[model samples]
Target chain A: MSQMEIKNITKKFADVTALDNVTLKLEENKIYGLLGRNGAGKTTLLNLITNRIFPTDGEILVDGESVIENDSALSKLYFMTENNYYPEHMTVKKAFTWTKGFYTDFDIEYASELCEKFSLKLSQKIKTLSTGYTSIFKMILALSCNVPFVLLDEPVLGLDANHRDLFYKELLKNYSEKPKTIIISTHLIEEAAEIIEDVIIIKSGKLILKESVESVLSQGYAITGSISAVDSFTAGKNVLGADTIGGLKSAYILGHLDKSGIPEGLEVTKPDLQKLFIHMTNR
Target chain B: MSQMEIKNITKKFADVTALDNVTLKLEENKIYGLLGRNGAGKTTLLNLITNRIFPTDGEILVDGESVIENDSALSKLYFMTENNYYPEHMTVKKAFTWTKGFYTDFDIEYASELCEKFSLKLSQKIKTLSTGYTSIFKMILALSCNVPFVLLDEPVLGLDANHRDLFYKELLKNYSEKPKTIIISTHLIEEAAEIIEDVIIIKSGKLILKESVESVLSQGYAITGSISAVDSFTAGKNVLGADTIGGLKSAYILGHLDKSGIPEGLEVTKPDLQKLFIHMTNR
Candidate 1:
């Protein structure tokens, strides 16, 4: 059974249509990348799924039941946003206690362990932690919540390289131990490409493409060679983007070409997620 | 002559030595990555150079003279921080006009063009712009300033994919037309690696490595093959990191190996800047 399903969902704010006839089915035990440019309605779709906002039209079902204002259904999901709201004068320990009451699966022991790993001070007030620390605190809550579905929107905003790598490793470890559905909305595509099993690309409030990560990347190839050779080879192909400097040229093509057809001294490589996204969206 | 020079720079905050006798030279017409883990004193160093704060020991020379309180030398540099402090009543156009007085090379026409390209309203007050637009406003100032030295500390913090790509392309175009000494401090290493000519890695408030980009990546290689073949090849080698799935293994090894020595059915590639930075700092 699908963990979450949105059928013909549409959300409008006055003259702005944030989402238009968006239909998506999220499976269980997989990592999905929710990607798009700014103002592409990725956040709107996520908010609708989490019931933070209601859809203007159509229906959303969680476990085959309407989710609007449904406590039992909402309890099965955890949604973490870029900006977290914490009450004033609340210490880390108090926040943990508060979340424990709301989430039955909240593991205080695991949360405490994560705090220690991230070197967070349990006694410090929520407002006293640095931006990166605040993110860690929220991540701890999300991970220990142990919900069937978790949604993270730009979770690594303020983290450094080491901390980001650590977060990814911990996420994978937790997933292996307790399989669940994860939807991550982020701009750092290449970094998360390996972990994401599927991808959903949104553009201008419309769903552009939704497919497995492997299938998405397999549709494009990057070719580099002399300017003349590259220009000739890319003549009739669907060129996503091209960069040229002096006599060297590199073009991202929509379809793969046979190895024998590529010119000598030219380099043909697989397109990274970032390159593909840039090419696809820019076009 | 160097655009900026740091001689025996040391900063101490009570018992903490934030920067430890660091000395470096920044030449003109190059982009340098001022990279390090959090609390590595990158912000402190930039503050010292910009004369916003004084160093505990040593000196910063701009154009062969100390820049402390010297308006003539300081006006040649522009530093864009995470938070821009413009009066709430100030409009975008007014901010541009005010910046013209501080920067001798400020170009109003160019600023207007960028404002349009970023879809910014000139009449909108600074407080009315969204977080992403605020960043774009600051970026416009930095680019249009045409200063000899530009320093950006996490300038692309909240930007989405399309805007970030636009920023990179604009930065490169500006650099190619008007070369300057630019230092960007960011956690997104791989995104910036292609644009930066030099890299400076810092750790624990100490300089770890500073070299050309090619030289840094030349020391590490990534090898992928069958689990057994990968394990045997990486044996006795400095394995910075490794990822395994089923029978396939990918190992990041220190030091380069001859192409002929690579095992059959194995793929050897260069390590990405982000991965390399994480491995280096974690170790």
Candidate 2:
């Protein structure tokens, strides 16, 4: 098992500071959701970890070894970025062969099976593939690479409803069969909430929250009732936000609910990850 | 007020038929969700309506006037495509000015206001924006175009969870203030379900279902319980799909669920739009 440690990493590009003193530990064999708003430095941090761009300060280590052009450590990692790296004219079949050359552990048979499931023709050129198919091609490679550490950035970018569902199920099945350290960076928070074991939320180039999914979800909830009743009930509580519709109101409050002291018309329910994320990051 | 009428429209590309005798109506001041699998011809239909491409058969009319080569009818419509069309070196402010020339009803003040709300700088060039920002810029244009008929193709494509939440809220607000015929085509069905008044689903270049959101969602539900219990309960019903985890099973069923005589341990809940779309479109 391999663990990645990002320590005090900082990156600046001309006038903007992309990342500032960001540090996090990616444990072995776990599914993590790296979440943030646009330009919040989620991609910057990922690029730093993959050694694509050098950090201005601090360092990244994989299994206690720095990941700065270290071929041995890099070989165990696979990053499926949003941009296509293969030649536009290359056939899907040839791209698979080329990928196998770099990652000797790549499973050709499994890739072919996935292709069949996704209805991707091996003879089709990469450039001719639609947006959805391009995403499928990259996802198939990411899943079949057989690396200890895998990073997927917006893995389901252009996938349709059915294909996205299929991808999630297949991903879970593959993970169960062979446990690996997986970090997924995506904008679809609700779809990924149930699948990710842990979550890391960053805002304005700084890490705001990092915790297990269960605990984070349990930490906050929504209470809805009459406007006056809700306002009085949440007087001293940490309220994130609220919405009013006529005489009714819904207030999102942080902290556990007391079952006995709740008012008659008020209803409390668990907040979904997307709602919580919006409240947390909506500055 | 304006209504879009698609009359037996058919489109072909070389040997492939993109759309096959599809007909639909967009009522004035209503929001419609245009949904389908990839390559199902959702974009083609939108393109045909906007006169971007000629239909091989039939015609499209806006408020009793043909759309083809009709500048007056076309002026009431705006189509926000997936690809960016603005000049690469043009600033966002300049693009806003350019759009006003073509779209006489374009609101420059509203566009600038939305840019501030989304934290998009007016001085930023179109080509230099990130994927999320690019989507935001286009969305701003669509919203401020002030046309009676507006078509948004993947408007929230790369937006984050917070931005997506904001976009939906803003869309609802804008629609409420000045009602228009809005057609949104996207893959995130559940997110758009509440905001969209009606749904139009296409499959393999043919129209499959067109109904109100309430009616479609109420037609199906999911029952979850022990494997044997779920199996016996859903034996004769229309089962869409099933998920099994150990001894427990969850089966998605179509048609109205009978309230009485349900199994003791089985729990019934609503089936989301995405689930219904998958079942409807899956071969």
Candidate 3:
């Protein structure tokens, strides 16, 4: 069964149409990447799914049941946003205690272990932690909740490389031990590309692509060669992006090419996630 | 002449040794990635060079002359930090007008162009701008400053993918047209790898590696093959990171490997900058 499904979701904020007829089906036990430019409705869609805000028109289902204000359905999901809205006076320990009441699967021991990994002070008030520490705290809570579905929106905003790596490792380890449906909404596409099983691209409140990682990556190729040769090679092909230096030119084409006919000294390589993202959104 | 130099730099915050006798030289007309773990003194070092804070024991020279409170030396550099502290009532245009007097090379036209590209309103008060817009305002000003050395600390923090791509393209275009030294401190290593000429890796408030980008990437290789063959091949190698799925295993090894005796189903590849960073810093 699908973990979560959004049918023809639409949301409007005054004059802005934040989401327009967006439909998505999130499967079970998979890591999905919800990628889009800022203000592209990724956050709005997430909010709608988590029921932080009601959709203007359409239905959101968690395990085939409407999730809006449904305690049982909401309890099965955990959403960690970019910013924290915890009470200012709540300490880390107190926050966990509160979360334990809401989430039956909350693991105190795991939360403490995560706190140690993040170097968080349990005695310190939630408002007192640094931005990075706050993020780590939220992440720990999200992971320890053990919900069937978890939604993380730009969770690594303030984290450095070491912390990000640790988070990814911990996430994978947790997923392996207890598989769950996870959706990560982020602009850092390349960083999360390897970890995500599926990619969902949103542009101006519309879905662009939703497919497996391998299939998405296989759709484009980067080729470099002499200006004339490169131009000729890309002449009839769908060129996504192009860069030139002196007499050399490189173009990222949106389809495969016959590698054997490439000119000498030219190189053809697979396009990275970042290149593909730029190619798709920059237009 | 070196663009910037630090000799025996030391800084302390109470009992914490933020920087320990660090020394380095930055050449002109190159982009250097100043990367390190959080609180590893990357910001402290940038502060010392820009004269924002005095090092407890150190000497920072710009063109062979001490830059401590020297207007002539300070005028040659510009630092765009993660946060801006503008007056609540200050509009984008007002801030630019005030900044123009401080730098002789400030270009008003270019700044306006950048503001337009970023969709920023010059008449909007600073406090009214979104986090991303505020960053764009500061970045535009920094680029317009036309200093011999420009330092950016997480300049693209809240920016989307499209804006980031635009920023990179504009930065490279500006550099190619005017050739200046640029230092960027960011956690997005792979995204900036292509644009950066040199890299400086710091760990625990100490320099780990300061080398050209080519030299750094050349030191590692990623090998993928059958689980058994990959395991055997990487048995004695310094593995930075490893991942296994089904019968396939990919290992990020620290050094070049002899490919002649490789297994039948194995594939060798170059290590990406992010993987290299995680491997180096996680250790």
Candidate 4:
């Protein structure tokens, strides 16, 4: 199994610290969710791992080998972001052919099949595509790269509902067959909550969480009841936030519940991923 | 009361039909969800209403007045799209001041307050902002324009979960305080479903469905049971699709559901909007 280790990495952009003393370990054959607010250094961390930008401190090691100036280690990783570096007039088909020159394992047949599924025209120029189609084109290339570790930042940036559904289903199918390591960075937490096995959260350039989705859900929960009942039950408890509508209220708590200590008319449920994220990241 | 009418509009680009003989009416103090697949002519419809492009057939009117080349009628409408028309060097603060030139009712103080709420720096140039921040800036402008009809095309594009939550909450607050016509075009159906009173779905440059969210949801259902049981239940029904996981199955169906007719060990629920949309638009 392949393993990547980020050890005490810190990145500084001029005087501003984009990442600070962050450490993580990613194992192969697992899908991870990289969750954070804007300017939370998620992109900076990805850049450091790919050696596109050197970290100010510490290092990244893939299979116990330093990734810096190492082409062999870098070749196994593919990072796809929103930025487009291809020529403005390059056709989608031509871009697919060009990608084959760098990545020997690029599957042109699979890409063509994906194009048909997405209803994307192969003859269309990259610059002429809409925002949603632009994301789709980049996603197709990333998926067909056949790399072990694929870093997808906002893969569904501008996709419509139907397209988003198709992409997620296709991704799960690919992972089940290939068993590769994948990390998705996206803002659509509720939609992505199901497929992502583990979540890594950052706040203000510091790692705040690294846990399995199951464990995270088990640790926290939401309680709903009358406003007064919820207030009394949440007294001195680790409350995240609460929403009240007329006589009813729902309070989010970041701790386990004792099932024996129950109140009538109160409902218990799993904590929402997006709600927890907002509560944890808010100042 | 304020109203806008779209009268038998059809837009054609060469031999291809961009929008085909569509008609709809918008009333004041209502929130509408405009939904469609990419290249399905949602943008074309918005452009036609704003008079950025004239329809090949028919016309658009605001309060019974032709919108084509009518500045007085157009002033009541504010369109916020992905495209940036501001000068590259113009900062967010400068853009707010410049908007006052065209919109006499543009609220500079409210725009400044919104910038703070969304954590947007006023001094940042429009060209230098990130994709998420660009959307935020445009949204702030549209909200503060004090217009009767506000059209937002993918306003939450590229925003993080926290920012999206904030934007929706702010939008609701803004609407409650000042009752105006608001149309939101987004792919995040589940998130937007709660706020939008009605949904308008377009497919292949044609309006497929336009109705209240409640009515649309009420008309369809989903049944879940064992594979054999689900198959038997969905047989000869208006089955949209079905999924099989191990021995369990779930089938999505259109038309009214007979709850009492469900077999033992079967569960039924309302249809999912995204699933309904996918089934409607798929070839």
Best by DockQ: 2
Residue A192 Cα positional deviation in candidate 3, in Å, after optimal superposition: 1.1
The residue-level lDDT of candidate 2 at A44 comes to 90
Which is the leading candidate under lDDT? Answer: 2
Off by more than 4 A, model 2: A224-237, A241-250, A261-267, B223-251, B261-267
Residue-level lDDT for B234 in candidate 1: 88
The C-alpha TM-scores of every prediction are 0.90, 0.93, 0.89, 0.92
Tens-digit per-residue lDDT, B72-152, candidate 2: 999999999987888769999999999999998899999999999999999999999988899999999999999998999
* Model 2 alpha-carbon miss at residue B151, Å: 0.8
**Candidate 1 has what TM-score?**
0.90
Cα deviation at B170, candidate 2, in Å, is 1.0
- The list of candidate 1 runs beyond 4 A from truth reads A222-269, B222-269
True contacts kept of each: 0.80, 0.97, 0.77, 0.87
lDDT, candidate 2, A97-165, per-residue tens: 999999999998999999999999999999988888999999999999999999999999999999999
Model 3 lDDT tens row, A7-32: 99989899888888888888899999
Model 1, A1-283: lDDT tens digits are 4488889999999999999999888899999999998788999988998899999998899899878999988999998886667898999999999998999789899889988887888899988888888888888888899899999988787899889888998899889998999999998888889889999998877888889989878877989999888888889898888877778988998776788988787899987888788877763
lDDT of 2 at A2: 86
Q: Rate the local accuracy (lDDT) of all candidates.
A: 0.87, 0.91, 0.86, 0.90
